[model samples]
Each structure stands twice: as C-alpha cells, then as structure tokens.
Target: MISVAAIDARIWQAIVAGAFVAIGWIVNGWQNRRVAAALRAERTRDVHRALYAEIASCLANLDSPEALAAYRDAMAARMRDDPGFVPLIPRERNDTVFRALVAEIHILPRVTIDPVVSYYSQLFAIEAMIADMRGERFRALEPERRIAMYEDYIALKVQAFHDGHFALRMIDAYATDGRNGAMEEEARITREISAGFDTAGAAARAASRISSPGAVRSGRSPE
Candidate 1:
C-alpha cells in the first residue's frame, strides 16, 4: 500500500503539471488572437488603398474640366446636322477590385460603405446610359429628343463626378485615421471641382446665347 504522504506528494505534482499546461494553452491562444488581429487590420488597410487608387483613377478620367468643355463644343457644333451625335463618353469601365472584394466591403468603416456603394451605383448608371446611346432606340428619337437624352447623360456624368469625389474623401479620411485635417483639404478640392463644372456650364450657356442672335439675324431658329 502507498503511504499517505507519498500519495499526497504525487497528487500535488500532477496538479502543478496540469496548471502549467493550462497556462501554456491560454498564452498560445492569446498570441494567436493578437497576430490574427494585426493581419486583419493590415488587410483592411490594403483594401482601402486599392479601392482609393482605383476610384481616384476613375475620377481622374472624368474630372477633366477641359474634356467636359470639349464635349460641349463638339455637341453644339454637330447638333444641327448630326442629331444622332453622342458626346464623348469615357470608355466602359470595370470595377474589378470592387467586384472581387464587395463581400468584404463591410470591413470598411461603417460610414464609408454607403458612399462607396453610392459612387459605384452612379458609375453603373453612367455606363448603362452609354450602352443605351449605342442602341437603335437612341437613334430613332427626334433631334430634340436626342438632345434631351444627351443633356440627361451630361447631368449623370456631373453627378458621378460629385459622387466619386465624395467617395474619395471618405476613403481618404478613413485611411489617414481621420487625422491631418483631411476634411478641409477635401472640401477645398470639392469646391474647386464644382466650380469647374459651373464655369464650363456658364461658358456653354453664354456661347449659346451669343449664337442665338446670329440665328435670329439669319432668319433661322436657334438650335
């Protein structure tokens, strides 16, 4: 038979060994959790960067005030004879990154997701209008109706520019951890771009007004 003292010593040793194993397991789990969190944060930031770059590129393609002016001029020049004329639209774009990672967009800050979705939605609308313009339905319309459609297309494009800027502002703020007075800088950019749009519109209207007198003098209706 074992002595009581010997049995008590064996039990104490078992308890100590089991306590060490449990402590080791808890520490290992904690370390794993910490590493996983770090990786997750890094991945989120990477997603933000990719999205920011892609959206910035798209916005750059559409943000040209000069391009907008050129389109207006080209349309005005062609409207009398080429009623079917279409203004220059950006090449159809694919939101590859956004499509691939849409499932994970939720990882973005809650406030950001809405603007991101909104911008993309505007882009899709623009693309759809571009597609429709290429179809026979657009060509079949009267000249006046076709002009109305073009006006609608320009309105949509302008709205997309505003939306793209807004999305970029939100993403930039998130990427910078909401520091560095980014909002003020973004606001200035927004204002400038908006002013560019306004200036282009004003110039186009002035040109139309100037041309109207010539049409009146020539006994022809202004286009």
Candidate 2:
C-alpha cells in the first residue's frame, strides 16, 4: 500500500501537469484567434483596394468614346458568356465613398436636406439598367434581336424618367399648397441629382483618357 504522503505528492504532480496543459491550450487558442482576425482584416483591406483600382481604371478610360463603346460591347459579351456575372447594379467608386460620407453627415441631429438617399436610389436604378443590359440573356440574342430589345429598354427608361418628373412636380405642387417641408425635400433631391451628374461627368472624362494608346502603354509599364 502507498503511504499517505506519497499519494498526496502524486495527486499534486498530476494537478500541476493538468494546469500546464490548460495554460498551453489557452495560449494557443488566443494566438489562433489573433492570427484569424489579422487575416480577415487583411482580406477586407485587399478587397477595398481592388475596388478602388477598378474605379480608377473606369475613370481613366472614360475619355475615349470608342473605348467606352468597346467596353460596353465587351461587357455585353461577358454577360453572354456568364449570366451569373451580372451584378444587380453598377457601383461607382464615388458612390461607395459618398455613402460613407453621407453616413457621417447623417450623424448630425438635424440635416435639412436628405440628398444621400435620393441620389443613391437614382444611381442604383441606372446601375441596375446597365447590369441588366450586360446579362447573358441580353447578350446571347442576335444583333438584330438585341437592337430591338435595346430600343424597348430605352423607351422604358424614358417613360420611367417622365413618370419620376411628373411625381416630383406633383409633390412640389402639394408642398406649395400646404407645408414648406415638402419643398425642402424636393430641393434636396434636386441637389443630389446635380451632384450625381457632375460626378458622372468627371468619371466619364477620366474613362475617356484611359482609353488612349499612350495611357494604355503607361498603365502596362512595371510599377
């Protein structure tokens, strides 16, 4: 039979060993979590960087009407090849940046104008139309068929624009009849539309320049 002292010593030794194991496990787990978090952060940063690069490319290439036309054609072709490539909308770099800006703006207790929402909504609709045109279903059609569809699409766009204009006018009339708040809202939306147009024009000019042969050559040079 073991002595009481020996038994107690053995029990203590086992407890010590178990404690070491637990501590090691905890350290390893913490290290793993840190590593995983760092990796996730790195991935997010990389994605944002890539989006920025693409946006810059779009802006640079906007100058060349021929290039822009070619880009549209290529995009259409891509859509024909892969239907799943279609995004719900075309997202501009400024759009994402502006959203972040608008979020910050909204933190103010009182924003007299709600430009952000109206601008983003209109931008989203335009993007959606572009995405739809680039889809495989549209691209797969014959040239004649595609042209026909495009006409219809343009017509629908025109109709929608008219409807939106009418709605705004009606709202303005109602506002004039009663509350000043409605007029304020209309003014905000108008401001957003103007800003969007200006930004788009800038983006288009950048895009055109990027399509130049010299620009293409420079872009291909080793950084």
Q: List the candidate 1 regions with Cα displacement exceeding 4 Å.
A: 64-77, 80-90, 178-223
User: Which candidate number has the best TM-score?
Assistant: 1
How do all models score by TM-score? 0.70, 0.35
Q: What is the C-alpha lDDT of each candidate?
A: 0.63, 0.44
Candidate 2, residues 169-214, lDDT tens digits: the string is: 3222222332244455456556867776432333344333322222
Q: Write the per-residue lDDT of candidate 1 for residues 1-223, one digit (tens) a residue.
A: 9999999999999999999999999999999987776666666666666666667666566655457657755686687578666555445774788888898887765546677798889878978998887777877878777777777887777776666666666555555534233455456556867777442333223222322221121111101
RMSD of each: 14.8, 17.3
Model 1 clash count equals 0
Count clashes in each candidate, considering only residues at least 3 apart in sequence or on different chains: 0, 13
Model 1 deviation from native, Cα RMSD in Å: 14.8
